[model samples]
Target chain A: MAQVRNKQVLLKNYVIGFPKESDMEIVEGSITLKVPEGSSDVVLLKNLYLSCDPYMRLLMYKDTPVSLGFHYSPGSPLTAFGVSKVVESGDPNYKKDDLVWGVTKWEEYSLVPSAQILFKIDHTDVPLSYYTGILGMPGITAYGGFFELGCPKKGEKVFVSAASGAVGQLVGQFAKLTGCYVVGSAGSQEKVDILKNKLGFDEAFNYKEESNLDAALKRYFPEGIDIYFENVGGKTLDAVLLNMRSHGRIPVCGMISQYNLSQAEGVTNMAYLIYKEIKMQGFIVSQFYPLYPKFLEFILPHIREGKIAYVEDIVEGLESGPAALVGLFSGQNFGKKVLAIAPQ
Target chain B: MAQVRNKQVLLKNYVIGFPKESDMEIVEGSITLKVPEGSSDVVLLKNLYLSCDPYMRLLMYKDTPVSLGFHYSPGSPLTAFGVSKVVESGDPNYKKDDLVWGVTKWEEYSLVPSAQILFKIDHTDVPLSYYTGILGMPGITAYGGFFELGCPKKGEKVFVSAASGAVGQLVGQFAKLTGCYVVGSAGSQEKVDILKNKLGFDEAFNYKEESNLDAALKRYFPEGIDIYFENVGGKTLDAVLLNMRSHGRIPVCGMISQYNLSQAEGVTNMAYLIYKEIKMQGFIVSQFYPLYPKFLEFILPHIREGKIAYVEDIVEGLESGPAALVGLFSGQNFGKKVLAIAPQ
Candidate 1:
C-alpha cells in the first residue's frame, strides 16, 4: 500500500498557566492508512471534526495529575473527542464506511484501538459535526450533569455560568425543557443574547458587565437558586454559593476560569454549603456514556423538531486546530467550538 | 410561684472575628419558674447541661446572614442545645419532670416553646449528660452527615477531620460500626489517643503538627479516601480534595476552622470535584429530626453494647459558660464541651 501525506496537530510543550496556540504545532506526517493483517483490536479512521473543549487544557500538562482522562504527550498528536469515519476495521463492531465518534488523534488519519470508539454513529440524519458536540460528549455531559447530578425540579430557579458555551448552552436549554426557570451568565452581550433569545434561557446576563455577581444572581433569583450548572468556576462558584437556596444542587461540569491560571481562585463562601444544605457534585461525560442511547432518544427528537437549538463555532483545516483549542480559554469562540479538519 | 434567680449568659456585642470570653457576659436575671397562665404552647425548663457547640458562634452574630439559624441579640440570654428537665408544661408531648434534649437558653430556668424540645430522654440507662454530647444535636448531625449522605459501604476508606470534637468523634465510631476503615485528624496528641485507642479508629494524627496537610493525608489515605466527614474545613478540605478517590463523598457537617475568622479561608481545590467525580454535600441536624426514632434505635444499642464510646469535657456552674463557649474556637477543650448548670 502506498503511504499518504498526513497533516497533524502536535503538542509542542507541557503547558503551565494559560495555553497558547504556539503550545501546539501543525506539522507534516506520513502514514499507511490500513488495518494490519490478522488484527482484531483497532480500527483505522479518517478524522473529520474535532472538539475544542476546556478540559483539553488539562491534558496539555506533562503528567495531568488531576484529570481522570488520558494525558496528551508532548511529542505526540493531541487526542480529542472527534467525529470520524472508519476507513478500515479490524473489529466486529466496526466496518468500512461506518461513521463513529470517540477519542481520535488530531491527524488526517487515526489508528486507534476499537475500545476508544465510544459509539458507532447510528443516526446520520443530523449534521456530522453534531457528533463532535451536541450529539456526543458535550451533549451527554449537559444531559447527565444537569439531569442526573443536578436532579432539578420543575419551576426551580437554575443558574448556569459560561451559559453560552458548549455544554452550558445545552444545559440551559435542557433546564428550560424540564420546566425550570433558567438564568445563564456569559462573558459578552452577544453570547448573552444567544443564551436568552436563541437557546431558550429565561434570563441571561453578561457577567463581565456586572460588578457584583452576587447581586446579579440575587436579582435573577430573589428566592435563591435551586440548581447551578457550574462551568466557569472560581468567583462565580463563590457567588453562587451565597445565593443558593436550602438543599440546592450545584453540578460542577467544568472549571474553565481556573484551568488557565497557575493558582485557581479561592472560593470563600463554602460555609453557605453547610448553611444552605447544598449538594455540589462533579461529573464527566465518560461516566455518563452508558446513558448515551437514552440521551439520543430524548435529544434527537428535540433537535429534529426544532425545539432544541445547537450553535457551533467551527473553522476549517487541521491548521486551525491549535488556535481554536486555545481560543476556548479566552472565550474567543461563541458556541460549541469544533475544528473542521475535513468535510463529510 | 415565687420568682427565682436565673444566672444567664448574654452576648456582650456582635462578634466580628474570633470570639473572646469578653464577648459574653454572665449576669443574674429573674424568671417566674412557671409555664405562665393559659400558655398551651410553652414549657418551663430547668436547664441542666448546656452544650458549647461551634455552631453557636454563628448565632452570636447580631443578624446571622450566612447561618440558617436564628440570631442572638446582645441583651438577651444565649440559646443552645441543652439537656433539660421540665418543671412545668402545657403541651401534651411533654410533662413535668420529663428529661429532654433541645434548644434552650443559657440560664438556670428557660421558658422555651414546647416545640423546641427535640427528644424526650427515654433511654436513661446511659448518663443523662449524653443528651448534651453523644445523643443530642451533634449526634444527629454525625449520623445524618455520615450514614445518610456518605453512604459508606463495608471496607471503604473513611477520614474524619476534628476527630475528637463532638460530631467527629461519633462519625469515626459510626464508620467503624459500618465496617469501614477510618482515619481521623485532630489538633492534639491527646485527641489522637482517644480516637485510636478508645474510639476504635484505624489511625489518628494531630493535624497541627503536620507542616503539609496534603502529605499527611497521603500518608494515611494512600489508597485515597472514599468518604471524608468534613468537620473543620478550609485548608483541610483543600488537602482532602487532593487525596480523594474517584466518586468520593465529603459530608460537610461543620466548618469550624472558618467560623472564627472574619474572612473564612478560601477553598481553592474545588476543581478536584469535577476531575474526580466527587460529591461534597452539607447538611444540618434539623433536617434529620424526622429520623430521630430510627437513629435512637440504632445508636442506643451500640451505646449499651460498649461498641461506642463518647467523651465529654464538662465544666461546672453557669458563670463558666462564657469561657467554655469561647474555648471551642481556641481548641481549649478535648472532648464534647458541656456546661453542667444544675444536677439532675
Candidate 2:
C-alpha cells in the first residue's frame, strides 16, 4: 500500500442559515491507495465529478430529520453522488480502472463500500461527467416524477418551476414528448430563453420578474394546468395550485426555494386540491431506481438522435466544490452543477 | 290544480365573511299540489328532512368558483339534499306517496325534476332522517374519502380532524374497522368523549383546547400518522404535515375552517410532503358514487350489529334551518346536523 495526497472538502461546522464558502474547508490529507485488508466489500476510487445538488443543503443542517440514507458530520469529508473510476477493488463486480457512478465523498480518493456504488458505467460514448447529472440522479428524478407520478396526457397543459435546472429541463422535454403544452418558470431571462428556444418548451417566463405569480401562471395556462412538476416550492406551488385543472396531478420533486429558508413560506391555496380533485404527491428518485435500465433505454436514443438536449455547468477542482454547491440555492448555476475533480 | 302554502328558507343575499342566520329569511310561497300537466319529467314533492352539511357554506359565498351543482339566489329558496315524499310524479321511477332523498329546495313543497332525485328510499329499518346523514351523501363522503383515498392498512396510525362531525366520525370508525389505530380531534370535550368512548377511537383530543397542535398530535400519534383524513384544515393540517410518517396519505375532504375566512390561513409545512414522500389528494365524493352499493353492503351490517353507531343533532321545523346551518361553522352542532321539517 502506498500513500497519496487526497485533497478534500470538509464541513467546518453545522450551518444555521444560508451557507457560505467559509463553512467548508478544503484540506489536503494522505490516504493509502488500497482497501483495508480483508474488507471484501470495499473499493478504492479516484473521484471524477461531484454533483452539486440542492438536496446537499439539507445535510448541512444539524439533526435534519430528512435524509437520503446519508449523513454528513463536522470535521469529515462531505459525501455526495459522483462519477468515479476504480483505483482498486475488493469486490468482483468492479476492477481497477473500471468507471462507475454512485455515492462518494468530496475528495480525491475514496474507499467506498461496494453496496454504495449505484451502477457500473456501461455507456461512455457521451461525456463521462454526465454521470454526475443528466445521465444520473436528476435524470431519473425527472422521469419518475413526471411520467410515473404526473401521468401527463396528450394535449394537456404542463407547468415546470426551476425549469432550467438539472431535473426541470428534462421534465419539460418529457412533457413535450407526451404532446403536452409545456410552460416553465425560471429565475433568469437567460434560463427562460434556454427553456423555450433550446428545450422546446411552448412558453417560458422569468418568475423573478413577475410581480404576481398567480396572474403569470393564469396567463401561461389559460385553460389551466393538467400536470405541474413542482421544483421551486413556496410561491410557485401556491400559484400552480390555483391554475391546476380538474383531476390535475402535481409531482413534487424538489423545493429548492424553501430549503434554505429559516421558516418555509406558507402555501395558502391548498384548498384548491379539493375544489379541483387534484392529486399532489411527493417522491424521491431513489425509490424509482429499479426503472433505471428502462430509463436509460428510453432516454439514450433521444440523446443520440438530438431529440433531447442536456446542459451541465462544470467547475474544475475539488477546491471549487463548496462555492458550486452554495451557488445552487441562489439560482447561480445555469444548469446541472458538477465539480470536475479527476475528469476522465 | 290545487295550490298549497309552501314555507321556505330564502337567501336574503349572497353571504360575505362568516354566514349569519340573518342572511336567510323565512318566506311563505305557494306551489301547485300536482305536477304540471305536460311536464312528464317533473315530480312534486313534500319536503321531509334537510341535511345541514359543511359544503353548503361554500354555496352561500357570492360567485364561488366551486359549487355542488346548485346555487342559492337572493330572495329564492336555498337548495340542498333532503328526504321527501313524492306527492305527485309524472316519471315512472316514482308514483304518488313514494319516499325519496335527493337535491330539493328548503321548502314545504318542491316541484323537482325527476333527474335531480338521488335515490328512492329502499331500506325502512333505519330512521328515514338517516337518509340525510349516515345513509346518504355524508355517508358516501366518509366512505369514499377514507377507504378510497386514505387507503388505511391494518395497524396503520390514522388521524381525523372534525372527529365528531358527520364525515369525520364515520372516517374514524372506518379506520378502526380496518384494524388501524385511530385518533380524532374536535372543538369541544363532549365531541372528544363521543369519539373515544362511543365511536371506538383509540384516542381523541379537543383541538380548541390544544395550544400546540403539533405537540398534541405527537402525544397521540408518537409513531407518526400514516393517514390523515383532513376535514378541518388550516392549523390542524399544518401541524399534521409535521407528524406524518413516510409515505403517509392525506385525503382532503373539506377544509371547513378555511371556507369562511376572507384570507385563508397559510400552511407552511408543505415541504414535509417531499421529505416524507407523502400523498395529499383532494377529492369530491361524486367520483366514488359508483361504489355506493358496495359501501352500503359493507357499512349496513356493522350498523345493524351495533358495531357502528351514528349521532345526529336534530332541530324541529324549517324555521330552525337557518340557525342550524349557521351553527355548523362555529362547531355548535353535536354531531350530524339535520333539520326535520315533516317526519315520516
Candidate 3:
C-alpha cells in the first residue's frame, strides 16, 4: 500500500478556559488510501466539509463526562461531524463514491467505523454543504428540540438566543413556520439584521447594546414568552426565565456563553420555574437522530420553495480550521461556520 | 347577627430579607356568625390548624408574581392552608358543620370563598393534624411532585433536599415505598437521624456539617442519583447537579434557601443538565390536584399498614403563628411545622 500526505489538526494540550487557535496545531501526516483487509465495519473517507460547534469545546478538556461519548487526547487528530465521501469500504452499508455525513477525523482522509455515519446523503438537489449544517446535526437539533420539547402552539410568543448561529437561526424559522410570533437576540447588529429581514423573524435585537437583558426581553415580549429556545445560557437564561409565561417550555440545546468559563455564572431567577410551572430540559443532537427521515420529509419542500432559508460562513483549507473553530467562542462566525477542504 | 372575637395573625408590612416575628402581629378582630347573605359561594369557617410553608414567604412580598395568586396587602390577615369546620355555608356544595382542609385566613374564624376549599375531609381515622401536614396541601404536594414529576423506577437511587420539612419528609417516604434506594439531606444532625430512623430512608446526611456538598452526595449515592426532589435551592441544588446520572429527573417543589435572600444565590452547575440529558421541572402543588384521588388511594394503604410515618412540630395558639412561620427560614422546625389555634 502507498501513502498520501494527510493534513490534520491535532490537539496540542487540554484546554482549560477559552480556547485559542494555538491550542490546536496543523500537522502533515500520511494515510493509506484503502480500508484494512477483512475489517467488518471500517471505511476510508475523503473529508469534504467540517462543522464548528459550541459543544466541541467540551471535548477538549482532560477529563470529559462519559455521556459526551467522544473526546480527544493530546497529540491526536480532533474529531467532528463532517461531510465526506466513501473512498473504500468493508461495511455492506456504505460503498465507494457514496456521499455521507457524520463523525469523522479532522484530516484530509479518515478511516472510521460505519456506525459513526449518521445518515447517507440521499438528497442532492440542495447545496451539498447543507448536509454539513441546516440539513444535518444542527437541523435535527432545531427540529426535534423545538417541536418535540417546546410543544409550541400557534400565536404563542417565541424567543431565540444566539439567533444567528447554526441552531438558533433554524429554531426561529421553525417557530415562525408554526404560526408563532418570533423574536430573536444576537451578539451583533449585523446578525440581528439577518435574523429579522432574511430569516422572517418578527423582531430581532442586538443583545450587546442592551444594558439590561430582562428589560430588553420585556420590550420584545410584552405579554411574556411562551417558548424560549435556550442556545446561550448564563444571564440570558435568567432573563428568559423571568419573561417566560406560565406553563412555558425551554429546550436547552446549548450553553455557548458558559462553555469556556472555569466557574459558570449562577442562574438566580430559577424560583420562577415553580411559580410559572415551567419545564426546562437539556438534550443533544444525537438523541434526536431517529427523527431524521421525518425532519427531511418536512424540510425538503420548504428548502426547494425558498420558504426556509439558511446561511453559512465557509472558511477554506484544512489549515484555517483552528481559527474557524476558535471564532465560535467569541461570536465571530456570522452563521453556520464550516471548514471546506475538498470538492465533491 | 352576633359577632365573636376573632384572633388573627396579620402581616405587619412587606418583608425583604429574612422574616422576623415582628413582620407579623396578633390582632383581635370580630366576625359575624353567619355567611354573607345571598352570596352563593361564601362559607364561614372555624379555623383550627394553620400550616407554615416556604412558598408563603413569597406572598408577603410587596409585588408577588401574578401566578402565585392571593397576595396579602399590609393590615390584612395572612392566608395559609388550614383544617377548618364550616360554621355557615351559602354554597350548595357545603352545609353547616362540614369538615374541610384548604386555603383559609390565619384567624379563629374565616369567611372565605367556597373555591378556596381544596377537598372535604372524609377520613378521620388519622390524626386530624395530618390535614395540616401529610393529608393536606403538603401531602398533595409531596405525592404529586414525587410520583408525577420525579418518575422514580424501582431500585433507582433517589435524593431529597430539605429532607425533614413537611414536603421533603413525605417525598422520601414515597420514594422508599416505590422500592427505590433513597437518600436525604437536612440542615441538622437531628433531622438527618429522623430521616434514616423514622422515615425509612436508606441513608441521610447533615449538609451543613459537610463543607463540600458534592462529596457528601457522592458518598451517599455512589452510583449517581436517578431522581432529586429539590426543596431547597442554591448551593444544595448546584451540588446535586454535579452528581446526577444521565437522564435524571428533578422535581422542584420549593426553594426555601432562596426565599429570604434579597438577591437569590447563583446556581452554577446547570450546564450538567445538558451533559446528563436531565429533565428539570418546577411545579406548584395545585397543578397536580387532578391526581389527588389516585394519591389518596395509594397512600391510604401505606398509612394504615404503618409503612409510612410522619412527624409534626406543633406551636400552640394563633399568637405563636409568627414565631412558627419564622422558624422555617432558620431550619428551627424539626419536622412539619403547624400552628394550633383551637380544638376541633
Candidate 4:
C-alpha cells in the first residue's frame, strides 16, 4: 500500500461561543490507502459529500457536559455524516466500490469501523449528495421528530421553526402530506419564499422581520397551534408556548439558536403547558434509527416522483468544510448545508 | 319550604397577583331548603367539607384567558370541590340523604346541577372529610399524573414537589407503592416530616430552607430523577430540569409557584429536555375523571389496611375559608388545606 497525502479539517481549539472558520484548520495528513490487515469490521472510505449539521457544533466544545458521544480533540479531524465510496471492506456486507452513507471524518480518505456506516446506498437514482441531506441523518431526523414524536393530525395547525433548513423543510412537507396546515418561520425572505412557494408550506414568515414572535404566531395561528416542530428554540420556543392549543404537542428536534449561546434564553411561558395540558417532548434522531428502512420506503418514492423537495447549499472541497459548517449558525446557508469534499 | 341563612365566601373582585383573604368576603345569603319545582338535574346540597385547591385561584380571575370553565363572579358564591349531603334531588342518580363528593359552592347549602357531582360516596367506613382530600379530585389527580403520565417503574427514582399538599402526598405514596425510590420537596419541616416519616418517601427536603435547589436535587438525586411530579413550578422546575436523567418524565399537575407571579420566573434549563430526551407533559385531573371508579378500587384497600396515610389541615367555619385558601400560597397550612364549612 502506498502512502498518500490526506487533506483534513481539524478542530483548532474548543469553540467557546459561536463557532467560526478559524476554529477549524485545513491541513495535510499522510495515510496508507489500505485498511490494516486482520482488522475485522473495518472499511476504507473515500469521503464524498459531508453533512454540515447543527449538532456538529456541540462536538467542537471540549468535554461537552451534555453527551451525544461525539467529541473532537483539539487536533483531531472533524467528524460528520457523509456519502462515501468504499475502497476496501473487511465487513462481509460491503464490497469495494459500494457507495455508503454514515459517520466519517472530514478528510479526503480515511479508514472507519463498519458500524459507523448507517447503510449501503443501494438507491443511487437520486443525487449522491441527497444521502447527506434528504436520505440520511437530517432525513431520519425530520421523519422521526415529525411523525413519531409529533403525531400530527390532518387539518391540525402545525408550526415549524427554521422551516427552510434541512430537517425543517422535510418536516413542513411531511406535515402538508399528512394534511396538516403548516406554517414555517425562516431568517430571510428568500428562505421564506422557498418554504411557502417551493416546499409547499401553507404559510411562511421571516422571523427576522417580526419584532414580536408571539404576535406573529397569533397572526398565523388564530385558533392556536396544535403541533410545533421546534428546531431553533430560545425565544421562538417561548413565543410558541403562549400560542399552543389545548393538548398541543412540541417535538423538540434541535435548539440551534441556544447551542451557540453561553446562557440559553429563559422560556417564560411554560405555565401554558399546565394551562393547556401540553406534551413537550425532546427526541434524538438516532433513537428512531430502527424505523429508517420504513422511513426510506416512504420518502424515496416521494423524492423520485417529485412530490417532496430538498435544497442543498453545497460548498466544494474539504478546504471549505470549516466555513460551510460555521455558516449554519449565522444562517448563511439557504437549506441543507453540505460540503463536497470530492467528486462522486 | 322554609328558607335558611346560607353563609357564603364570595370573591371580592378579580385577583390581580397573589390572592389574599381580603380578595374574598364572607357574606350571608338565603336559599330555600327545598329544590325548586320543575327543576331538571337539580340537587340541593348541604355542603360538608370544602377543598381549598390551587386551581380555584385560577378561577378567581375575571374572565380567565385560559378556560377551565369554572368562573367566579364577585357577587356569587365561590365554587369548588366539596363533600356534601344531598338534601333534595330532582335527578335519578342522586337522591335525598345520599352522601356525595363533587363540585359545589363555598356555602352551607347549594342548589347545583346533578351532573356537577362526581360520584356517590359509597365507602362510609372512612372519614367523610377524606372525600375532600384523599378520596376526591386531588386523589385522582395524583393517580392519573403519576401512574398514567409519569409511568414510574420499580426501582426508578421519583421526585414530587409540594410533597405535603393534597396531590403531592398521594403521588409520593403511589410512587413508593409502585416500588420506586421516592424523594419529596415540601415548604416546611413539618411537611417534610410528614412526607418522610408518615408517607414512606425514601427522602424529603424543605425547598424553602434550601437556597440552591439545584444543589439540593444533586445531593438527593445523585443518579438523577426518573420522574418529577411537578406541582410548584418556577424555580423548582428549573432546578429539576438540571437534575433529570436521560428519558426522564415530568407530569406537570400544577404551577402554584407561577400562578401568583405577575411574571413567572423564566425556566432557563428547558434545553435539558432536548439534551436528556425528556418528556414533560401537563394535564388536568378532569381528563382522567372516567378512571375514578378504578382509582377508588385501587386506593380503598390501601386505606383500609393503613398502608396509605393522608394529612389534612382542617379550618372550621365558612368565615375561615378565605384565610385557609390564602394560606396555601404562603405555605402556612401544614397539609391538604380543607375548610370545614358545615358539620358532617
Candidate 5:
C-alpha cells in the first residue's frame, strides 16, 4: 500500500447565501491507503474523476429541516460522484483493481468503510470518465425522471430548462428518441445551438435573451407543453406553469435557480398547476438507484449503436477542482463539468 | 311543468380585484326549460342550491384564463354545482323526480343537455343538502385527494388548511378515521375549537393569532407533516413546505386564500418541496367524479357509524346567496357555507 497521505477539501463555514470560492479550501495530510490491521471491512480507493453538480451549492448552508442527502459539514470534503479504482479491499466481493462509481471525497483518495454504496463498473467499452456523469447518477436521473416521472409519450410537447446541462441534455435526447417534440432553454447562445444542432432538440432558446419567458414558450409550444422536465425553478417554472396543457406532468429533478438563494423566489403562476390539474413531483436520483442496472441496459445499446451522444467539459488535475466545481453554478462550463484526477 | 323562465346573474364587468357585491347582478328573462323540439339528448330543470366556490372569483376578471371548466360569456349566469330535479328529460337515463348534482346556472332554473356531467344521488338517507357540500364534489375531493394523491398512511401526521371549510373539514375527519395524528388551521378561534373539540382533530390552531405560521406548524406537528392537504395557498403553504417531512405529499385541492386577489401571492419556501422530495399534486374534483360512488360507499358508512361529523353554515334564502358564497373568501363562514334554496 502507498504511504498514508490524505489530500482533502474542507468547508470553511456554513454559507449564508450564495457560496463564494473561499467557502471551500483544499488541505493536505497523511493516512494509509489500506485499512488498518484491526479493521475487517474497509476499502481504500484512488478517485479518478469527480462530478461537479449544482445541488452541492445547497450543502454549504447551515442545518435545515429539509435535505435529501447528508449535509456537508464545515471542514469536510464535499460528497459527490466519482470514478475510483479499488486499491485495497476488506470485503470479499471486491478485489484490487476493481473500478467503481459511488460517493467519495473530493480528494485524491478515500477509505470507504462499507462497499454497499459503491457499484462496480463493468462496461469498459465506453470511457471510464462517463461514470462521473453521462453514464452514472445524472444519466439515471434523466432516464428515470423522464420515463418514470415525466411519462413522456410520442408527439408530446416537452420543455426542458437548463437545456445543455448534464441532465437536461440527456432528457432532450431521450425525449427526441421517443418521438416527442422537445424544446429547451439555456443561458447562452452557444448552449442553445448545442441543444438544437447537436443534442437534437426540436427547438432551443436562450432564456437570457428572452424578455418574456412565457411568450417564448408559447411561441415554441403553440399547442402547449404536455411534459415539463423542471431543472431551473423560479420564473422559468412560473412561465412553464402558465403554458402547460391540461393533465401535463412535471418531473422536478433539480431547481438550480433557487438552490443558492436565502429565500427562493416566489412562483406567481403556480395557480395554473391547479387550474390545469398538473402533476408536479420532486424526486432525487438516489431514490432510483435500484434501477441503475436497467438504466445501463437501456442506455448502453444506444451508445454502441451511435444513437445517443454525450458531451463533457473536463478540467484536468486536482488543483483546478474548486474552480471547476464552482463553475457549474455560474454557468461557465459548456456541458457536464468533470474533474480528471488520473488516467485509466 | 312551470312556464320556462331563465333567471341569470351576470358579471357587471370584469372585477379589478376582489369581487364585491356590485360585481354581479341578477336578471330574469323568458326561456324554455323544456328541451328544444329536435334535440336528441337534453334535459332542462329548475336550478337549485348554486354553489359558490373560490374559483368563481377568478372568473370575474376579464381574460385571466380563470375558467378551468368552461368559459362564461359576458352577461351570462355563473355556473356551479347545484342540485335540481329534472322537469323535462330528453336523455334516456334522466327523468323527472330524479335528482342530480352538476354544473347549473346561478338562477331559478337551467336547461342542461345530455346529463353527461351530472351524477344521480342514489343514496338519499343523508341530507339531500349534502349533495352541494359534503356528499358531493367537495366530499369526493377530500376523499380522492387525501387517499390517492396525498397517500396518507396510518399514524402519519396530516395537516389541513381552511380546516373549518367544506373540503377541509372532511379531510380532517378522513385523516382521523385512518388513525393519523391530524392538525388543522382555521381563521378564527371558534373554528379552531370546533376542529379540536367537535371534529376530533389531534391539534387545531387559529392561524390569525399565530405570529409565525412555521412555528405554529412546528408546535402542532413536532414530528413534521407527512401529508399536507393544501386548500388555502400563500403564506400558509409556505409554512407547510418548511415543516414537511421527507416523502411528504401535498394535494393542491384549492388556493382559497389567493383566489380573490388580482395577482397571486408567491410562496417563498417552495424549495423545501424539492429538498424533502415532496410530491405536490394539483387536482380538480371533476377529475375524480368517476370515483364518487366508491367514495360515498366508503364515507356514508362512516357517517352512519358516527365516525365522521360535519358542520355547515346555512344561509336561509336565495337573497343571501351572493354574500354566503363570498363569505368563504373572507373566512367569515364558520364551516361549510351552504345557501338553502328549498327543504328536501
Candidate 6:
C-alpha cells in the first residue's frame, strides 16, 4: 500500500534559563501511516491538540539529572499529552478511527510503536479538548495531590499558589468540593476573579499586587493554612511555610516561578516547617497513573455536568507552539495553554 | 515528715540574641513532698541531669508564639528533659525511689503536678544520664526521623549535618547500622573525628574548614546523597540540595546554624527538591512520644549490649547550667552537653 505522510515539530537544542522561540523549530518530517511489512505492534495517529505544561521547561535543559518524568532529548520532537485519532493500526486493541489521549510526539501525526500508555477517549460527549487538559494529566494531578497528598478536611483552610493555572484551578475546585475554605493566589486580577467568582474559591488575591505575601496570607487565612498546594516556589513557598498550621501538608506539584531563573530565589523562613510539623512532599503525575481510570471516573461526570469548569488558551498552528509553551513561565498564557495543530 | 524542698532555676528576663550567663539565675524554693490534701495526681522528685538543647534558645525569647511544649515565663525556672528519682508520690502509678524521665524544671528538686508526659525508666542497666541525652528525646528523634522519614536502604549514601551534636551523632550511627554509607559534617575537627571514629561514619568533614560546602559534599558523596538528616540549615542545606540524589529524603530535625542569626539565611538550591523529587519532612519528637515504648523496646537492647555508644560533656553544679545551655549555639560543648545539678 502507498504510505501516507505526516509533519512534526522538533527541539533545536537544549535551552538554558528561560526558553526562547529559537530553542524549538517546526521541522518538516514524514512518518508512514501504516506499519512496515512484518511489523505487528504499531499504530499511526493524527494529533488534534497538544498540552503545554510547565514541566516541559525542564525537558528543554541539556541534563536535568533524572527527574520524575522522562527527559526529552535535544534534536528530537517534544513529547506531551495530546488528543489524536488513530489513522492506521497494527495493534490488536486499537482500530482505525479510535480517538486516544496520552504522551505523543509534538506533531500533526505520529507512528507509535507501542500503545501501552494510551487511553481511548470514550466520553466524546464532553469537549474533545478536555482529554488534553482537565481530563488528562493535569486532572489526575489535581485529584491525586489534593485528595491523596493534601488530605483536605471540611472547613479547613486551603491555600494554592498559581491558582489560575491548569492544575491549580482543579485543586481549588476540589478543595471547594470537599467543603474546605479555599484561598488562591495568581499573578493578575483576572485570575484572582476567576478563582473567587468562577472557581468557587472562598478568597483569591493577585500576588503581584500584594507587597507582603505573609501578611496577605494572614489576612486570607487568619487561623493559618492546613493544606498548601505548592505550584509556585521561591518566596511563595517561604510565605506559605510561615502561614502553615500545625501538622500542615504541602503537595508540591511544580515551581513555575523559579523554573526559568539561573539562580532561583532562596526561601528563608523554612524554620517554620519544624515548629509547625509540616510535611512537604513532591510528586509526579506519572506515579499515580494506575489511578487515572479511577480519576477519570470521578472527574468526567463533573466536567460533563458542567459542575467543573476548565479554561484553555488555544494557540493555533504548530509554528506558534514554542511561544505558547514559553508563555507559561512568564504568566502570559491564561488557564491551560494548548496548541491546536489541526482543525476538527 | 518535713516537706522535701523544691529548688528551682528561674529566668530573670527574656534573652536577646545569644543568651548570657547572667540571663538565667537559679533560685531555691520549697514545696511540700506530699501532694495537697485534695490533689490526686502529683509527684515529687530530685532532678539529676538536665538536657541542654539548641531549641531552648527559642524558649528564652519572650514573645514567641505558643508551641506544643511549654513556653518559658520571665522570672521562672526553665524546663527541659531531665532524669529524676521520685522522692515522694501522690499519684498511685509512681512510688518512692522510682526512676523517671520527662520535661522538668531546671533545678535540684521539682514538684510535678501531673505525670502525664513522664515515662518511668525501667532499663536501669544502662547509664541513667542516657535519659537526658542519647536514650531520650534526641535518641527517639534520630530513630523516628532516620527510619520513618528517611526510609533508608542498604548502600544508600547518608549525609548528616551537625553530626556530633546530640541528635546528629545518633542519626549517623543509625544509618551505619542500616548498612548505609554515612558522611557527616560538624563545626570543628574534634567533632568530625568523633563522627568518623566513634559514630561509625564512613567519612566526616568540618563544614567550617571547607571553602565550599557543595564541593565538600561532592567529594564525600560521589554518587550523590540519598538521604540528608538536616540539622544545620542555611548554607549546608543549600549545598546538600545541590548534591542530592534523585528521590532523596531529608528529615529536618533542627536548624541550629540559623537559630542565633537576626534573620534566617536564604536557601537558594531548594529548586532541586522538585527536580529530584525529594521529600523533606520536618518533625517534632513530641509527636512520636506514643512510640516511646516501641522505641525503648528496640533501643534498650542495643545500649545494654554496648552496640551503641554515647558521649556527654557534663558541666557540674547548677551555677554552670546557664553557660552550658548557652554554649550550644556557639558549638562550645564537645559532646551531648548536659548539666549535672545533682548526682543520683
Index of the highest-DockQ prediction: 2
State the lDDT of candidate 1 residue by residue for A1-344, as single tens digits: 96998899999999998888899999999989899988899999999898888888988877675665567888799988999999999998899989999999889999989999999998989999999889999999999999999998899999999898889999999998989999999989899889878998999999999999999999999999999999989999999999999999999999999987778899999988888999999877788999999999999999999999999999998999888988888889999999888777
What's the TM-score of every candidate structure? 0.98, 0.98, 0.99, 0.98, 0.97, 0.95
lDDT of 4 at B34: 90
Separate DockQ for every predicted complex: 0.77, 0.81, 0.76, 0.77, 0.66, 0.63
**Model 1 ranges off by over 4 Å:** A67-69, B66-69
Query: Worst 10-residue stretch by lDDT in candidate 3 chain A?
Result: A61-70
Residue-wise lDDT of candidate 4 within A1-344, one digit each (tens)? Answer: 79989999999999999998999899999989888889889999999999899988877767575676667888989888999999989888898999999999999997999999988898989999999988999999999999988898999999999998999999999999999999999999999988989999999999999999999999999999999999988899999999999999999888999888888788888989988899999987789889989999999999989999999999999988888888889899999999898887
lDDT by residue (B1-344, candidate 6, tens digit) is: 56555667788888777788888887777766665666558777788888888888877777663285588987788888888888778888888988888888788877776554368898888878898888888988999999999999999999998888899888988888899999988889888888878778899998889999889988988899999998988999998999998889999899988777778999987777767778889988887777888988888888888778787888887788888988898899887988887878
Q: Rank the candidates by DockQ, best first.
A: 2, 4, 1, 3, 5, 6
TM-score of chain B of each: 0.98, 0.98, 0.98, 0.98, 0.95, 0.96
Q: How well does candidate 4 score on lDDT at residue B271? A: 77
How big is the positional error of residue A149 in model 5, measured in Å on the Cα after superposition?
Answer: 0.7
Q: What fraction of the native alpha-carbon contacts across the interface, defined at 8 angstroms, is recovered by model 1?
A: 0.82
Tens digits of per-residue lDDT, candidate 5, A37-58, equal 7665777788899888888887
B276-342 per-residue lDDT for model 2 (tens digits):
9999999987788778788889988888899989999999999999999999999999999999998
TM-score, model 6 to reference = 0.95
Docking class of 6: medium
Chain B of candidate 5 achieves a TM-score of 0.95
CA lDDT of each prediction against the hidden true structure: 0.90, 0.91, 0.91, 0.91, 0.83, 0.84
Off-target runs (Cα >4 Å) in candidate 4 are B63-65
Q: Find the 10 residues in a row with the least total lDDT in model 6 chain B.
A: B60-69
Report the lDDT of model 4 for residue A9. Answer: 94
TM-score of 2: 0.98
Compose the digit string of candidate 2's lDDT tens values, residues A41-130. 999999999989998888999977585888889999999999999999999888999999999999999998988899899998888988
Show pairs that collide, candidate 1: none
Q: Estimate candidate 6's RMSD in Å.
A: 2.3
